[model samples]
Target: MILFRRRTLLLSFFVAMLVFSMYLMMSGNYPKVIYRDSGVPDAEKVSTEDSIDSTDIESVISTNGSGRDFFVEYRLERDRLRSQEADYLREIINNPNASQESKDKAQKDLIALAEKVEKEMNVENLIKAKGFEDAVIILSGDSANVIVRSEGLSTKEVAQITDIVTRTTGLSMDKITIVERSN
Candidate 1:
């Protein structure tokens, strides 16, 4: 009877151990499954390049928008600056309290500011060096009651160039006019 009881105890212990091991494996605590779908096929399977359609390639290209947004954003910013400049010039001219010396000083300051802005906007070197053939540079200055012509550049390009030149020249961005040229 003692021998039989000992054998039964040993068998029960083995069964419990087997159940625990199985539970661990099924519960994902143990790495039971060795293989998974890696998305890439094995050497025996056909490749993805051969299966993809031409339309998929076209779709990818179409999804990438062009530089139109950059151009528009650049234009709007330029126009805002131009308006501000006009308003500033008007204020200076209309101020009756300003003495002759003060007016002369203001005029000189405006010219110097415009020239500095123009020099900064001069991205001819950068545009040419960067190989941006589509780009055009335009310049404007603070000479009141005089029409200044840019080398056939669009008003937008002019403003953009002005902005760039001002930034490069460390002048106030608001004081400069940048415009874009339309081809």
Candidate 2:
């Protein structure tokens, strides 16, 4: 009975987090990306390259305001998505009518989800410790995307970030794509 109550509390906390994140996303606190039909040819559109220059970011930020932090918004969105996934897993685990097999799978998934969250947090902290102003990392299957808050990254800086990600995430250098988010 105590265990069940604890699970209930945990579920409630996650639900609250999800709701708060959604509110932030919907409240116009962050810049919204607008797709417009400029007469520019598709071939002449903004480069979709990994390195997003300050000019690119400035144009995007111009729509809303200057004080927006891309890293913070990305982190909030990531947390919101994870929170929703966790809430669904919790529901499956807590459903009394769920079969044992389904509950077991849900429990396994939940543990994996927690581990992924912790690993991402650790990687972010480690990156910041390396003197970055801010960093956001997203790990998927065998690939990881590391976006750092900077106008540009030197070769050495890229090496440092790549090493940190490879060491922390066990992803090969080729599989990790590092990008710069200009402040």
Candidate 3:
């Protein structure tokens, strides 16, 4: 009888403990919760109404008044046209069915179109002509250098040719260098 009574008491104790644990969980007061502090500064405590001390307002005004916004828009348009022209050239070069004759004709047509565009836009004509060997224009430190490596042209002749090119391009004569290579 004593063993039975002890067993009943132990069972009742376990049930009470379980109910107490459930109540604590449902009430949400068993585990202490902690919150992290946000690192933002209080705007109300900071002063931001200070006046700027700068004496370049007049200079800024003068610089800003120099040109219309249309100038930038026109430059963007010109850049777009140049990009399109490059794409067209690439397409022409990559066409497998393009014969040598057709390619030559296409190149001539492209140059004419480019000249027309240059005249209309007041852009400098950078490329004059291309032959069996490439003609390169080298601009180094305010000097224009034209180098052609092909056929029978002496160093002196190349220099003279470069001078002529500089004169025709309206570039400074002192800044132009021409080099030619003979095969």
Best model per lDDT: 2
Best by TM-score: 2
Give the winner by lDDT: 1 or 3. 3
Weakest 10 consecutive residues of candidate 3 by summed lDDT: 49-58
Query: What tens-digit string does per-residue lDDT give for candidate 3 at 86-133?
Result: 456546745788887766665554554444433322212222232223
TM-score of 3: 0.26
Q: Can you write out model 2's per-residue Cα lDDT over 1-183, one digit (the tens) per residue?
A: 865775676556556656865886798644565434442424433334422223443433343243445676456446656767777887898899999899879877776766676677778878888999888787776778788988889999999999998888788999988888786
- After superposition, the stretches of candidate 2 with alpha carbons farther than 4 Å from their true spots are 1-67
Query: What TM-score, computed on C-alpha atoms, does each candidate reach?
Result: 0.30, 0.66, 0.26
Residues forming the 10-long window of minimal summed lDDT in candidate 1: 141-150
- The per-residue C-alpha lDDT of model 1 at residue 76 equals 32
In candidate 1, what are the lDDT values of residues 1-183, reduced to their tens digit? 853564365446445645854684487532223223453434533222312222322332333243232222332333344435534644674589877676656555444444433442345434433333333233433211111223465656555555544555555656544333332
Between candidates 2 and 3, which one is better according to TM-score?
Answer: 2
| C-alpha positional error of residue 18 in candidate 2 after TM-score superposition, expressed in Å | 12
2 or 3: which has the higher lDDT?
2
- Go through the candidates in order and give the C-alpha RMSD of each one to the true structure: 34.7, 9.1, 35.9
